[model samples]
Target: MSDLPLDQVRTLLAVVDEQSFDRAAAVLHVTPSAVSQRVKALEQRLGRVLILRTKPVRLTGSGQVVVRFARQLTRLEEDTRAELGLVGAAEPVTLPIAVNADSLATWFLPALAAVPAVGSAPAVAFDLHSEDQDHTATLLREGLVMAAVTSAPNPVQGCTSARLGRMRYRAVASPAFVARWLTDRPLPEALPAAPAVLFGRKDELQDRFLRGLTRRGATGVRHFVPSSESFVDAVAAGLGWGMVPELQHRADELVDLAPDHPADVPLYWQQWKLDSPALATVAAAVVAAAATALRQ
Candidate 1:
C-alpha cells in the first residue's frame, strides 16, 4: 500500500482546484517550487503522473483519483472538526454537485432547502453543475462533482447510487398550437410537422417519444431553448410543443398532446461513498424531496 502523505494529497488537490501550480502555491501559502515538488512527489509515490503541465493545469486520469480522494478527505476532516467542536478556523463546506437542468428548475431546489441548517457546523454552500441527467454521471466519474442527479442506475466508481424516483414528462403545447397542428391530425403525423422545443441536442425525450410512436425523428420547426425554466415557457408561449416535466407543466394553459404517452425518466442520486455528515444530510433531504415531487 502506498502510504501517501496527507499534505502531498492536499497539494495535488490545491493545484487542480486552482488550475495552476502558481495559484496553488498562493492558496497553500507556499512557494511555487514547493507546490510542484509536493505534487511530483505524490505522483512518484502513486507511480503515475497526476497532472498535465498546461496553461491551466489539467488533471490526468490518475490525477482525478487523487483529487477525488483529497476532496473526500477534506470533507471528512471538516466534518470531524465540526463534530468535535474544533471548527473555530475552518472554512465553509462547499459541495460541488451535478444535477439535470429540469430538476434544477424544479424540485431539486426544494431538496437543497430541505437540508436542515446545522448550527455550529460549517456553513454549507452548493456549486451546482447543470447538466443533462443522461450525462451527469460523467461529472461524478471525472471527479468534477461529489454527487449527481443521473439517469444511470449504476454508481460511479467510489460512489453510491440511490433511486430518487421517476420524473414524468407530459407532452404539452399551447391550446392554440394544438388546435392548429394537432386537432385533426394523427399524433405521429402532426407531431413531426409541428414545432417542437428541445432543451438541447442531447435531449432525446421528444425524439424518443416521436420515434416510439411513429418510428420517425422530430424534424419540424424546432427551437433550442437550453434553460429548463424557459423551456416550458417556450412551449407555453406557442413556440413549440415539448415534453415538459410534470413539476413544470403549467396545466391550465397547456394541453396534452398525448396524455397516455407520458415519459417517466427514472432519476438516481449518486454520491461519493463517504461518511461525511453533511453529505449524508444532503442525500437524505434530496431523496425525501424527490419522493414527494416524483412518481414513486
Candidate 2:
C-alpha cells in the first residue's frame, strides 16, 4: 500500500476515463510523456499491465481492480469534502449509474426527479448509462458505474442488491398487424411466421416469449429496433409484433398474446457496499419509485 503512489494511480484512472494517454495528460494538466511514464511506473510497481493499446484503451482484469480502487478513492474524498463543508459550487459530486433502456424511458428518470441531489439541484451531477437490464450489473463489475438496475438478484462482489419489483411485458401488436398475421391462426403457430421486432441484435425477449408459448425460438422476418421508444413505436406502426413494456403507450388495443400470463422481469438495485450518503439517497429514491411503478 505504501509503495503505490497516488499520482500514478490517479493517472491510470485518468487514462482509462479519457480513453487516451494524451487526453489523460490534458485532464491532469501534465505532459503526455509524463502520463505515459506514470502509467508505466504504476504497472511496474503493481507487476501488471492495466490498459490495452486499443483506440479507446480497454482495461484488463487487473486494470479494472485498480480503476475501481481509484473511483472509490475519489468517492471517499468527495464525501469527506462534503462532510467538511469544503465543497463549493465549482465542483459537483458525481454519481455514475447504469440503468436499462426500458426503465430509463419510463420510471427511472422520474425516480431521479424526486431526488434533489442527483442532478442539477445540489452540487451534484449524474453520469447515467443505459444498458439492458440483464447486463447492467456488468458496469458495476467493470467499475464503470457506482450503481445499476439489473435483472440479477445476486449482488456483485462488494456490493448489495435490493429487489425493486418486476416490469411486466406483454406480447402485443397493432390491430392491423394482428389481423394481417396473428389472427389467421393460433398465436403459437402464427407468431413464428409473423414479422417480429427485437430490442437489438442481443434481444431475446420476443424469442423467449415465443419459446414460452411454442417451445421454440422466434423465426421468420425480424427487425431489430434498438431504441426503447422506437421498439414500441415500431410495433404500433405495424412494423412488427414484440414484447412491449406495460408502461409504454398502446396506440391500439393490444391483443395480449397470453392474457393469463405475462413476461415479468424482476429488477434489482445494485450498488457498491459503500458508506457514502449520496449512493444511499439515490438508492432510496429508486426503490420508492419502483414500488409505485412496478408490480410488487
Candidate 3:
C-alpha cells in the first residue's frame, strides 16, 4: 500500500476548500510555501497532477478524489469524537446540504424546524446551498455538501438515496396578459406569439410543457429571471407567461392558462453513506415534510 500522509491530504483539501493557496495557508496557520510544498508532495506520491493552479485554484479530477477523501476523513474524525464523548455535550451539529430554490421557498425551512429536539444539545445548524433540483447532486459529488434534494435517481458515489415525491407545475399568466395575447385563438398559435419568462437559460420545464401543448417547442422570445420568486413575479407582471410551482402561486393574481395540464417533476433526497446522527435527523424531517407537501 502506498503511504499517503494525512497532513498532505489535508493540505490539498484546504487548497480546494479555500480556493486559494494563500487563504488555505492562513487557515492552516502555515506559510503559503509550506502549503504549496505539501500539495506538491501529495501530487508526487499519488503520481498525478492534482490541482490546476489558477487564480482561485481548481481541482483536477484526481484532486476531486483526494478532496472527497479529505471531507470523509473529517466527518469520520468528528463522529469518533462524538462517540467517545470527547466533544462538549452542548455542541451544535452542522449539516451542510444542497436543495432546490423552489423547495427552499416552500417546504425546506419547515422540514428543518421539524427535526426532533435533542436534549440540551445546541440547535442543529444548516449550511444550505441552493440550486435547481436537476443540479443539486453536483454539490454532493464535489463533497461541497453532505446531502441534496435532486431530480436525479442515480446516487452520487458513497451516497444513499430515497424518492421524496413530485412537485407539480402549471403554466400560468396574468389574466390581462392572456386576454391581450391569447384570447380568440388556439393555445398553440397564441402561446408561440406571446412573450415568456424562464428560470434560466438551462431551464426547459416551461419549454417542455409548451411543447406538450402545442406539439412544437417554445419560441426564443423569452426573458431569463433565474430566481424562483423573480421568475414567478415576472410572469405575474406580464413580462411573459411561464410555468410556476403550484405552491408558490396562491397569494398571486396569476391565472393558470392550462389548469388541467400540469407537469409533475419527481424529487429525491440523497445523502452520504456515513451514519451521522445529525444527518439522520435532518433526513427524517425532510422526508416527513415532503410526504405532506409533495404529491406522492
The numbered model that scores best in TM-score is: 2
Clash counts for the predictions, in order = 0, 0, 0
> Which window of ten consecutive residues has the lowest lDDT sum in model 2?
116-125
Model 1: weakest 10-residue lDDT segment is 114-123
In model 1, the runs with Cα more than 4 Å from the true position are 18-26, 29-41, 44-47, 53-58, 88-90, 117-122
Candidate 1: C-alpha lDDT? 0.88
- Model 3 lDDT, full chain set: 0.85
Candidate 3 TM-score, C-alpha based? 0.91
- After TM-score superposition, what is the CA distance of residue 211 in candidate 3 from its true location, in Å? 1.8
Q: Is 1 or 2 the stronger prediction by lDDT?
A: 1
Q: Superposing all C-alpha atoms, what RMSD in Å does each candidate have to the true structure?
A: 2.7, 2.1, 2.3
lDDT of 3 by residue, 76-134 (tens): 77666766777675765677799988899889899998785532233466889988888
lDDT tens string, model 1, 1-296? 24779999999888877878899999999999999899888888888988999998788888888788888888888888778877654456778899999999989998887675532345677889999999999888877789999999999999999998999999999999988889786888878988999999889899888988789887788899999888988998999999999888788999987888889999999999988878888888899899999999
lDDT of 3 at 244: 88
**What shift in Å separates residue 200 of candidate 3 from its native position after superposition?**
1.5
Residue 171 in model 3: lDDT: 87
Q: TM-score for every candidate vs. truth?
A: 0.87, 0.94, 0.91
